[model samples]
Target chain A: MDGVHDIGGTDGLGPVGYRPEEPLFDNPWERTVFAMSFPAMASGLNLDAFRHGIEKMHPVDYLSSPYYEHWLFTMEKGLVETGLLTEEELRARTQQFLDDPSAPLPQRSDPAAAEAIVGFLRSGAPARREIDAKPAFAPGDRVLVRNLHPKGHTRLAGYLRGKRGVIDAVHGAFVFPDTHAHGLGEQPQHVYTVRFDSVEVWGPGADPRTVNHFDMWESYLVALDGDTDDRAALDR
Target chain B: MSTDHVLPVRPDYNADPTPDPVVVARVKALESLLLEKGVLASETVDRVADLYEKEVGPRNGARAVARAWTDPDFKQRLLADPVAACAELGIGGMQGEDMVVVENTDEVHNVIVCTLCSCYPWPVLGLPPNWYKYPAYRSRIVKDPRALLRGEFELDVPDEKTIKVWDSSAEVRYWVLPQQPPGTEGLSEEELVELITRDSMIGTGLPRTPDSPAGAR
Candidate 1:
């Protein structure tokens, strides 16, 4: 949903993927993350050049690092690039770790491991889903996906929300909380999908046959129109 | 860079994966700077660095996922605004911005790969595994999702579906609303919740029968 495309619809243009900027280097991934992440990380930090320095690098290495690996890596990168970590300090730390025979090291690690229930490994596992509760939206309901583009850590996409949509299908619910991504306590919430009309999202002139749906956590949406209007929207 | 055009140990573009000495140096320097600036305490930074990879990392996301699978409407709301739904579950809220969730259906499936740095939905799904950010996996997966998935993740999608690969551009993160698996419908919310594997939610794998979760990795 993000672009500089003239939304006045007077340009006679459709919803096109705005390149944002000229394609940098050859890799799209690198161009995307580098341009985005450091600025976000910079938000929490007190420095500007430090953030700029970190953003200058290609993001290929970033994709090569795991999620938090990048986090860890970036922190280190920022420190070094900004005159915080000295050449000698890194060398000393590396050398010491190599020599320390008694130092504890992590064992097997997995990135997608969190996706599967740990109980899946055990023969008899505790249930992870809570079935008795009723879901928030039904066959037809109007909802909005909040539009937010933050620098440091953000979860919202430009295209998905704000453009009006309806609730087409109701999937089961799961644990959603409000907290920092790292290990910590949480504030409980729920999730769902509110379908959007291409016409509404792209403007009244959009393809009537086309419909878009996005999954949302309850906290993201506030009802704009009731279910009946949504049902009618979906029927079209 | 994610391609197999194995670099001939060259000068520019294709560099080694070795941790950058300069970057590491910068990290240490930044730590010291933060301390000097009174922005952070050296001992606190050391403590943060110490337990970070372990303690204050991805565990919270795991708990959130487990809780979601156990609750229904929360799941629906989760399906609505992932970030807000997460807030309902007490997971994450406006540390800065909000979040949205997208469900993957039979006709249209959502696959997330960070073409840029490996930006992920860590707050909800936890930190990503190493292979996710691997050049080998990133390059091949988008061009050939079904094949690579079968090879790396051992996942196979039906031929009829169209895969919409999301190349994350901004800091905005994405997660898959994996289809809930069959056979556990009548089971208690708790039992049904047990079926919600994190991988399934990611669209990398599907939930299995209670009897079947025994063999998954």
Candidate 2:
């Protein structure tokens, strides 16, 4: 899905702002949204489900919405899907504040739960999964990214599709997100660091010496017979 | 060293104001319901917030950088397998499990960007900065990295040095091991850590010089 969130090489996004000293969260609400995301998943919402919910949003809404807003919207969607809350219930809650602006909402009964969430967040979870599979390509092999446009969730960025690169290193098997995102099994596959010349990606007049490397799953690549720089070789 | 190309005015990507009241209300409502249902406890939320706000951040990354500077074996381990090396220093987890530290050299300069999204080593560098996730950064830093480095960051890359931009497009996140600044040979590991800024690790800026005051950039 070519969503607005995939704004890698697109233009007109404006300048990169800088702050001398940045805060962890700019506001209290940002922290609130961040805190809810962990527990929402802890309560049964899968990480993929959460990501898909965000991807499901209208492009315009996604583009204009701030970062945390995306998280909040996804949290709401996940809760509704998990039978914890309904659209109307969420709407009513929003409307309640719209109507009075001073209403006291519910607070957590057990304050200790926040500690547990923090502990979990501090001791981060590793996404790498153990799997027994031979790597299709090894370091120094030439390969081309298959021109793929999967309608489902995928880590294959739009820019890297249909490009040629060299296998820099092989990072043993890890759960492939494309399959894992769809409730499809965690089909672990070898992940490789594919090194693509900046010219190979952006085309002529680009920096020839500059290389852009992407961590690609094995399923997204097809082996090239030999190292070739000709454009025609890549098309095949 | 000269190109006539004009750089666009960088936008204030951090312009998002104190979140809108309605957005606040919505999140507050969701929290209340989850709390009432016992699905999430407030204590956990508070703790997570505190962990990010105080316990974790760029300081962890500084320690890693400083250690690598002082110990050649650790630096080799960091460059070879960042996950295991970071673990030796107790800095591996979360988005950093598949970490790969790219070393910066005289002939080549390394910078990191996640064009698809903001995939950063949170456990090591803490949460990402606002600009790292901005659209302008995700777009310009790849196609015209030299421009972004010069125009926005004020760190000009010499024509002789090739800039290799690592777009973290997968589970693995990258952090730049900026070359240790010259003239700091006698500094202790703790002193070196103070010179390591978050921007240097991200490859947008160089590490702080010992003579310059902190946050001078």
Candidate 3:
């Protein structure tokens, strides 16, 4: 399930488009999608569900769609799958909007409910949670990112996979979104700041003094054996 | 949390700003359905959007940065435990959880990007700007920090100063405590907070000099 959303090291993405006067939301619909994400999650749709829904998008749709468009697509997918809204009902409503974009929505009956949802979104949800899981590695330990190409959700980028790096810091344990996204469980693990050399990631003729430090979960790494010693030496 | 092993050899990144009427209809439909079903209340969407758009923003991060600038003890605590420190100042939530504050010094310059996705410390700096999520900024920033900074933000780090790029690949978020501008020793914490622009904390730009035009943003 290698989704197209993971675009990291590949080049030719072009220049960063700078918007001098970028408004918070490009359009009114963007605001609705943005707002819906909060309550969708609050109503029991976890972060992973929302993210997984996006990953479920067809490559063409994902790439062609704009940022907020992606959100809207995934939000609808989650809502439909979770039984929050029937597909037929959603389609009918969509047709209504398509017929007239300015049509008013079926407003909330209770004002207090809106206030509570708003309050919840404003406070926000924190993913960090106390876990009994212990860290496998410590700072200064040299480890290699396991060459993994899982068919599901993962935080490990393709470029950094299989690369050796030193653990700069141990960031305690947190919810493992890879598993949590799939309704498995919060398989918490130790997350570390793994530092990789520019030369190692980009090849030689790169800045040796410079390095990339990334937060990597313990599951993505394996202790390097003597075989990796030569690469580690070159890294230094 | 996604991977791309079978993606096209060279997929083009096109950012279309124009809204798709079909998708807009779908979103509108979804909103109405959720509201009618009582799954979500009306104005809930507006409140969340407003919360990020107008309520929370870089000013929160500026306040934290300002407090750290003035109080060495607070700075130490901020670096040691960003969540606790930020929570102490009331800036801890969704994207802000497990914050890692990177300090900018004469020897080292720190910048952040989420190569896999745009993961930022939202409680502090609010939602990331569009540039942060764009393919160009995400890809180039990690590969060539010097060139990208100079070309995009007019930020030139001397060849001698080491550039460290932190990619927020995991949930842990990062924000830079940029080096305080020179000749601002007498400024109050509130003034310092005003000087801390969102870009400076992101390391794409720097704090404004006292004499350099007011309000760089």
Candidate 4:
């Protein structure tokens, strides 16, 4: 889905801010939200599904809220939507904390569970999966990024849509996020590093000395027959 | 180079000095609910935060970069199969399951970004910085990286050098293999490690020279 989160190539968002010694977390709440995300995942929320929840946020709120606030939104939404917790329960619990600053929250010491979650974080869940399918394109092949604008979740960035690029490298088949996010299936496919010259992507005026490369799944690309300017070639 | 362009100011660009109280309550509320419902133990949350704070981070990535600077074989391995190479130094996992380390040389420079989201190598460089996640960097870097690096980061690349911006739109995470600075041949791997700042690996900044103030032992 085209959302505010997909902010590549869009102009006038202002200068990038940098801090020489930025702390890991800006606020206490930020740390809590970050830490909770792992266990929330341990509680059966899919990573792609969690990302889509953030994508589903209202465009205005997505931009205004801080990063962790977005995570908090996803966690809350996932828990409720998955039937783990009710809306009233969450609202009442929030009110309790809001009303009493020193409210004693529930706690449990489960060292075994703690270690398991930390171990999982240490060794991440690898998205690469074995599929008995050959890669459609190989390195050095000229391909066109299919002009796809899916209303559902997708990894294809809007800026790269309908652009031309060359296959730089072929990564093994990985779980396709488009299907994984919707609980359809892994539907794994080969992911390639597609290289786009700056001029091709940003037009002739762009600095010819630069290039942008993106990791594109096989389905997002189409083989170009020859060096022709026919836009119709994309559909064929 | 493109300095004449007037960028729009986003009101929420900078984080507020004080966090919202309601937002604070909401997270605390969720934690309590998760615990009561047996979805998450408080210990698990604490352990996860501790791992990032104490165990994993830029130090791991710095060590890998420094090792490459000293060992040519390791550098080849890092360039060819970064995941396996980093694992030789015990620095592979999490968002770094499939890693690609691009080399920065005299003619070409490399930078990594996730235009769609903040996909960073957690076991290596740790979580991404605020600017890496914000809209300004995400939106402008891919379009005019030379301008963005020069204006915002204060690191100006010469016109002759080519900038390759890797937009990590998929699972394969990317990081920079910063060129070893001149006059650092005599330094030990440990000494070289001190010079590899997090931003250097991100391609926004260069590695520190041995005689520089920050690189001084």
Best by TM-score: 4
Q: Candidate 2 chain B: worst 10 consecutive residues by lDDT?
A: B2-11
Q: What is the interface RMSD of candidate 4, in Å?
A: 1.9
How do the residues A1-236 of candidate 4 rate in per-residue lDDT, one tens digit apiece? 98888999989777676777778888888888898888887777789989988998898888777888889998899878778888899899889989996798787778898888888877889999998999999899999999888888899998888999999999999999999888888899999999999988999889889999999999999898676654885676
TM per prediction:
0.48, 0.93, 0.91, 0.96
Give the C-alpha miss distance for residue B31 in model 2, angstroms: 1.2
RMSD of each: 13.7, 3.2, 5.0, 2.4
lDDT of 3 by residue, A74-157 (tens): 777777777777778888888888888889877676667767876665465656677776788988888888777778878888
**Candidate 1 local lDDT, A1-236, one digit each (tens):** 12221011122111111121221222322322222233234334222222223344355443233233344445455555545555576566545444553343223233233112121211111112455657766767766565544343223345554566677655454333223332122233345555555556566654343344444555566665654353343333
Model 2: interface root-mean-square deviation in Å: 2.1
Deviation from native of the Cα of residue A44 in model 2, angstroms: 2.4
For candidate 4, write residues B1-217 as lDDT tens digits. 7664564456444646488889989988998988888878878766888888888999999999999999999999999999899989988778999989999999999989999889998888998988899877899989999988888887999988999999998889999999999999999999999999898999999988866785321
lDDT of 4 at B207: 88
lDDT of 1: 0.45
Name the candidate that leads on DockQ: 4
lDDT tens per residue, model 2, A102-212: 777566666667766766775666667777667899999989898778787777888888888899988887777777766687788889999988888999988676778
Pairs of residues at least 3 apart in sequence or in different chains that clash in candidate 2:
A15-B10, A15-B11, A111-B43, A113-B43, A113-B44, A114-B43, A114-B44, A114-B45, A115-B43, A115-B44
Residue-level lDDT of model 1, residues B92-202, one tens digit each, is 521103344556677866666653334466556544544444444444443445655565566777666665555442223566666656655566655655555556655
DockQ of each: 0.05, 0.62, 0.48, 0.68
lDDT of 1 at B86: 66
